[model samples]
Target: MSEMRLYDAAGNRLYLNAEERAAFLAAARRQSARDRTLCETLHYTGCRASELLEITPARVDLSGGTVTLRSLKKRKDAKGSPRIVYRAVPVPPEYLDTLNTAHGLREAAKSRKKANAPIWPIGRVRLWQIVKRIMIEAGIPDAPHRSPKGLRHGFGINATVNGIPLHMVQKWMGHAQLSTTAIYADAVGREEQDIAARMWG
Candidate 1:
């Protein structure tokens, strides 16, 4: 017998079609305060769910509307020496309000417990549960390979479709290689083709 691939053999590896994206956002907007913040953070910053859960108040610069993602990827130098690399990603201006709310909630939780802490009080598992619950509530099917990664993919696709340069997307996504960014550019090529068809028609 052959081993099964991690992804479904006959389905899309990613979730969030255009309609589903809209439904997801709308459903997220209807969620409770904390869940709403989590959804907004995931959608706006395109950070991994683990990264979002690791966020600290210090990592978010509300004045600049940016969030720094700590090094999740291992770095290898010319000699194959391993190091850590952090990436700074800009968040949408709208996330400022959501961040402020999340900060306030975290501070309040800390105060109630007499402990100072990070903005997200939950662990990675809890974050996953939160995202899963939100997706299910939004009527999205829970595919094996689909999770908050879909949100990141949606952000990249939308950004590329909107004409953000591949280099910039790479920087925002914290991708070390330009090739990774080009994949997103290629994903948006269909949109470009549709636009061209409209122009010629």
Candidate 2:
């Protein structure tokens, strides 16, 4: 049997450029409201699709403008006991607005769902389908080398490039290992070098 990877194995390993990010968001906006919300949630939170689906209204602390992530990784104690990982991620202002709008729309639709209802009702299969469609609309090739995972990687790379702290990035990504977060540090260094070259030249 092949060894399993912690992260999903799909999409280009490269981070998205500015133009590509714009195209992705534009294409997402043209999609159904549900899809748009999903895209916004993913871009804002940098959480896995499964984690995004698990988000509830209550998980968002509007006053503090943060969203708490209940990490999906399973842990065991020395004696082999089960435990849960959890992290609190900041909510971008725009994302909070999108969530507010989505919540209002849901309420207006007269859905009596509980406040703790899943933010995204779509199943994982449907989520993948939606991602595929959006990628096509955004002019991405229909290949495993450029899928939704690329978007997630893009988010992390972008954050690091913009000088967000590595530890914070790890927390936002819910990564247990600092080494995992270090991968994007190289990208940030490259970005810095490019900026320096432009200034000198």
The TM-scores of all predictions, comma-separated, are 0.78, 0.79
- List the RMSD of every prediction in angstroms: 5.1, 4.3
C-alpha lDDT of residue 8 in model 2: 38
- Clashing residue pairs, backbone N/CA/C < 3 A, model 2: 12-145
Inter-residue clash pairs, candidate 1: none
Error of 2 at 100 (Å): 1.3
Top candidate by TM-score: 2
Candidate 2: regions farther than 4 A off:
1-14, 77-79, 105-113, 143-145, 189-201
Q: What is candidate 2's lDDT per residue for 84-180, written digit by digit as tens?
A: 8777888777767777786763453344455577778778888888877887888876544255666777678778878899999998988877888
TM-score of 1: 0.78
lDDT (Cα) of model 1: 0.71
